[model samples]
Target: MERLTIDDMKSIELEIMDEIDRVCQAHGVQYFLGYGSLLGAVRHGGFIPWDDDMGIIMMRDQYELLMANFNEWRTTERFKLVSYRDKSSIYQFAKIVDTTTVIFENFVGKKAATGVWVDVFPLEHFSEQQGPALLKQHQRTGLLRSFAVADPSVGTNAFVKLVKRIVCPFVKNKDLYELAERLDRIALRMNAADSASTLVIDVLGEGKLEKMFSKDLLEPIRIPFEDREYFAPSGFEEYLSIQYGDWRTPPAENARPVHVMEAYRL
Candidate 1:
């Protein structure tokens, strides 16, 4: 795979977000620029400085509709829909363009061109509880079961596999949606430590991260998304560390934002 420079990734992120916004707006579904995307809007008012991707969340039903419509757009425009399951398990975290086209092809060999990309996450329900507490409980136990029940091939990506092992049961489809941004923090930290290593599984010198997955923490919520609703899972603080490492502290001025968009939430 080719590595993208900061500027290249930013352009891809905005282009995809524009396409996504168009579809969501036409459908009348409530779509939030979420995860790092949201953080980018908040902190940098655009793309995060070091970020290389974009993410968005909608309720399951809306997301389903959005994807269906997006597929039509893909066929009409001659763009490809990259499926992680087909590419590699590691790619499960997102879908990317199979070949350079559009900005990718145009920018190839350029100083800042990047792989074209986008990710859609489904936000589940979490009680009105504080964020940290909810994060912990999920990481401890319930999230594991959720992952186990997830499609058999989800973990083809090592980091995703580790995430499944930890938060499967307690993590419902909805919870996984909302929790994606949070877990991304952990992934980013892992990336910082070693770009080549798998943060979810490889970071654990012992079975610590995996062992943390065995605990039981579940708080389910039924929330509305698009025309329908679904259950989302969540947990507590311990789960946060296990899944995301230490995100408890606020970032320093020079510190890189965990999810570039996170700062914009407020």
Candidate 2:
């Protein structure tokens, strides 16, 4: 593995997409482009030149099948599947596991924190029998409410997981984002690392690292390196007002920067 520049990252993104497509096609598992990948298709007819992650949706059964054959897929290109389920702790607010990102960081021998990696979000569809129909329906209502609202009464954490499994598909990039923020807030408040990590897992499950710090705050637009393009959470421009103040781009001094990769062991 080598340190991936934006160009290198994009090239890798295509290869990963092809691998997922091939595997899903072979298994009869249905998947859809998610997050930046889907947004790219809609906004740029491809990846946002600066975007560096990839995500997809599949039912739990399909995810099981994919995990079962993960070893076979590993040979496709030296990639690794990273999931927080494997490592959730009360000690840390959050963590991202990246087979490729960790390797890339080491190869580059750089000290900067790097979040460059791919994420696979599992899509869990819900029916009235399984989850609150209103919450599921709320996804289509307002993006903000759909994302930030959480039911604190559900104690097992199973309920929230069920919500994520079901509701993520119906939302847009903006909505997807709002949902992430809301979940993060609930997790932090309840100290429910299990549920919180599971939620974050959806965003960066397969080795890519994206932040899930404050669910209330929106992530900033990021330009990882010189000559590379800029990327932000989907529809970042729309939420800039509430997140960073006035919608107009802020001065560099007032803006927060997106964290990338940091070469170190957990």
Candidate 3:
């Protein structure tokens, strides 16, 4: 097997995005390019030069609709949608994976394996009053996630390393998987439509509570992405400004980091 180069990774990601676009359009399910993927679309017109992944988000309703019809809509021979409901899937979120390729990341452990993929996030409704409860739930989920993956090499600092070493011995992978299911339920319950704010609950590791935005911001608008156009939040500028102040400016080369993953074309 040969490792994929940056160009190869980008090519595969574009394929995944195209398929997602096709399914969402056919079903009238709205989705928006988000996070770093949005940043790249607006600034670089594609994946950021150093970015290796893509992300798209849909509101809870659209997300659920997509999941309900996923098997019928998805190209089974080419891609598969993996979500928390799948026993081998570790993340609470969903991923659209290319079946004829392989992309392995250490954080996913052994049970789950998928090829080059794009992350599909659900924007959960949230409210200011729910902050404390959300934080507590996130903490528990975060701990379970860490235990499930349990890579001692993850941290560089002594304090972080020591904490992982201490906790690693006590948590079993099976227990972690079971706890993740409970966390998923809690997350689903928190997504009340009456709330004024919204968050991507599966992105808890990114301090998502602070990343929350007004539900009004979710109204979709089309924007250019790579040579094609895709939807983004109508208030994307406001959302981006909050998540990354002065998002128009490119980061320093050294500051532009991509997650570590090994990819190969089948």
Candidate topping TM-score: 3
Those runs of model 2 whose alpha carbons end farther than 4 Å from true positions after fitting are 73-77, 84-116, 127-259, 262-266
Query: For residues 80-194, what per-residue lDDT tens digits would candidate 3 score against the true structure?
Result: 7876675536666678888788877754454556778888887776645665576677776777677656665456578877877777666644565466566656666667633
Measured by TM-score, how close is model 3 to the native structure? 0.89
Report how far residue 233 has shifted in candidate 3, in Å.
1.2
Candidate 1 Cα outliers beyond 4 Å, as residue runs: 1-4, 75-78, 84-115, 126-250, 253-266
Instruction: Give the alpha-carbon lDDT of every model.
Output: 0.41, 0.40, 0.74
Stronger candidate by TM-score (1 vs 3): 3
lDDT comparing candidate 3 with the true structure? 0.74
User: Where's the lowest-lDDT run of ten residues in candidate 3?
Assistant: 198-207
- TM-scores of all candidate predictions against the true structure: 0.42, 0.42, 0.89
Compared with the true structure, model 2 gives a TM-score of 0.42
Model 3 stretches astray by more than 4 angstroms: 106-108, 157-159, 193-207
Top-down lDDT ranking: 3, 1, 2
Candidate 1, 190-262: lDDT as tens digits? 3344333212231111113342331133243333322233232233334344544553543566776332211
